[model samples]
Target: MDDPLAWLDDTAQARQAAGLRRVLAPRDVVEPLVDLASNDYLGLARDARVIEGAVVATRTWGAGSTGSRLVTGTTRLHAELEEALAAFVGTAGALVFSSGYTANLGAVTALSGRGAVVVSDVAAHASLVDAARLSRARVVVARCSAPDEVDRHLAAAPETRRLVVTDGVDSVDGGLAPLAALHAVCRARGAVLLVDDAHGLGVRGPGGAGLVAEAGLAGEPDVVTTATLSKSLGSQGGVVLGSAAVIAHLVDAARAFIFDTGLAPGSVGAALTALGVLRDEPERVAALHRAAAAVAASARSAAPELGVADPTAAMVPVVLGEPDLAVAARDACAAAGLRAGCFRPPSVPEGTSRLRLTARADLSADDLALVDRVLGEVLPAVLGRTGVSAG
Candidate 1:
């Protein structure tokens, strides 16, 4: 007789053979190394002010949210964050969720259903992909090479309600989507545009208002936006911004929002504090952009054969064809006193494994110098290519 879990071994063995196995390697709290893997773009995760905000909230409220938002989890802090997020993003209203992943689910599913059509970009994040699959709508994936593919898909879909989903800045190569053009297509086709601005908020646009605001699409009746507080905000929650009507609909109909527990008081307070910090220090956004450009330039210099381009946001991908080479590159970075992210199959495509480096506004000259040295030493040998130089 076969064991009930016999398939697990087969899957594990297949993954190991393909070099797609993953393992956790947690870092020390007080390590003497520079971090280029995390999404803390503003470096406010450890800010004293943000920490105090969390501490005060936990002391006053409880550690957990206690219940769902419709129940006892709706605190004054949550209300405050919602209002501030709406105002900053130039939307009519906002709703807070336990996490960005759930927020995307709530937005995509609630906005589309049976007899509806959902169009998604080829390079959308995994959360968005999962959301589209669960939405129960007719899904159409737009081709990445063709700019007019999404518009054509929207035009060809039946007269049912259409929802177009895309990322403001793609999480993989850090390339920016043509939001203004897409918005025009949506407007013409009587479809709504939903942008996941997780990578764009607090890094792109003026004063970090995000790509929607940058394109003058914020507060538009046909546009909806979702973002995470965990990235640039240095907090731990997600938000959805749209018209008042859309907000009301999600609160009433979204299963993800209705069933999920509310965001904790500490996370709400921390996000509120971080938003305040962003408002007060807009210069940090500029610094972050400069750093992203610097890192991308360095990557291109180190491996011109890779054809790396300047990133539109904080993510810089150093493409290595095979998974083993990508892992080796990451290990080399760690040995050189740096922390870089390793992206393998599933996170990226099968053949395009890469080292994903994120930029923080607080990186110093020494940090960049270290990056140059590490890449110069690792890229040439691991990649086995010429024209490799350190920045």
Candidate 2:
């Protein structure tokens, strides 16, 4: 009999021909390059205090959660992390999930069902897109950053239950969504609002509380926020923060939360510790914003034609508009002793492949200078330009 998976080989061949095949390049425990690719904005992933928190939690709670959260997976550390997150972000309650992706899945699926409508931004993250697909609601795609468009979609929906979902910040370009405007639109329609603050938490808002709080929407009965501990917190997990009723509803109804094992104790402990650090040392948040601005400014100065935008968060993109050029630019960066993330099709819209540079709170002037030096070498080759000086 013919192989049942032969079609997959054909698809792989098609991807390879189109320059879209993806491969993992895992880093060593001790990397030699200056990493501008990771999402660790606070630079706390390697901090001694954070490490100690993880170590103590592992010693006390063991290595694994071992069961779904509804069972034995719920630990004291989990509850502590949830409480700290809710309090930190100014929410009435919080729930922890194994990952940011699962948190989005749980929030979207649990809140919207057969008789509901989910109006999502066109530029939402992949996890949110998948969540919308799984929601079983009539999904409406509205233009990114356009609250008026969202209003029209919500007004036209036949379903009485409406949930408007959006990312607090666009992951690729690092531009903020119009949260207050969207919230107003949702409120006018008596709809619930969910903001995925994956990129906004620990980087935007007061004391790194998140964008929902920054926009003065925190603790609002109609609003809910989801965030990832892996990004700014330098840990691994996700959280959903909202009213007590929403938290209780998710606990009973969210399949992603009910069926998946809870977040590991070490991650929960580390996140809790990270929250304390943020509360005490809020300067780290400001430092991160400055770093992002420096990175974007340097990139723009080197190649004025590249049209790099000022970042509203920790990310800056150098759009190359083709997959091969993006891959080549990334390789050039690697050769210059710097690491940059490459974004191609699906991660970004077609014809907008680019380099994604992230900033860390710990980056110094010398580090920014090094980035300038590396980009000066790489930009000319990718952009076909001359006189792109390092200084």
Q: Each prediction's TM-score against the native?
A: 0.97, 0.97
Instruction: Report the Cα lDDT for candidate 1.
Output: 0.90
Report how far off residue 145 is in candidate 1 (Å): 7.1
| Residue 243 lDDT, candidate 2, scale 0-100 | 98
Per-residue CA lDDT of candidate 1, range 1-391, in tens? Answer: 7799999999999999888998777777898778999999998899999989998998888899899999998999899999999999999999999999999999999999888998988888888899999999999999533548888898789856999999988887788888888888888998999999999899988799998899899999999999999999999989999999999999998899999999999999899999999999999999998888888777787778788887788989998878988988998889988888999989998889999999999999899888888877778778764334333
TM-score of candidate 2 on Cα atoms, chains taken together: 0.97
Task: Show pairs that collide, candidate 1.
Answer: none
Instruction: Give lDDT per model, in order.
Output: 0.90, 0.91
Number of the predicted model whose lDDT against the real structure is largest: 2
* Candidate 2 deviation (Cα RMSD): 1.8
lDDT of 1 at 155: 75
Q: Which ten residues in a row have the lowest lDDT in candidate 2?
A: 382-391
Question: Model 2, stretches more than 4 Å misplaced?
Answer: 385-391
Location of the lowest summed lDDT over 10 successive residues in candidate 1: 382-391
Tens digit per residue, CA lDDT, model 2, 187-240: 998889999999999899998888999999999999999999999999998999
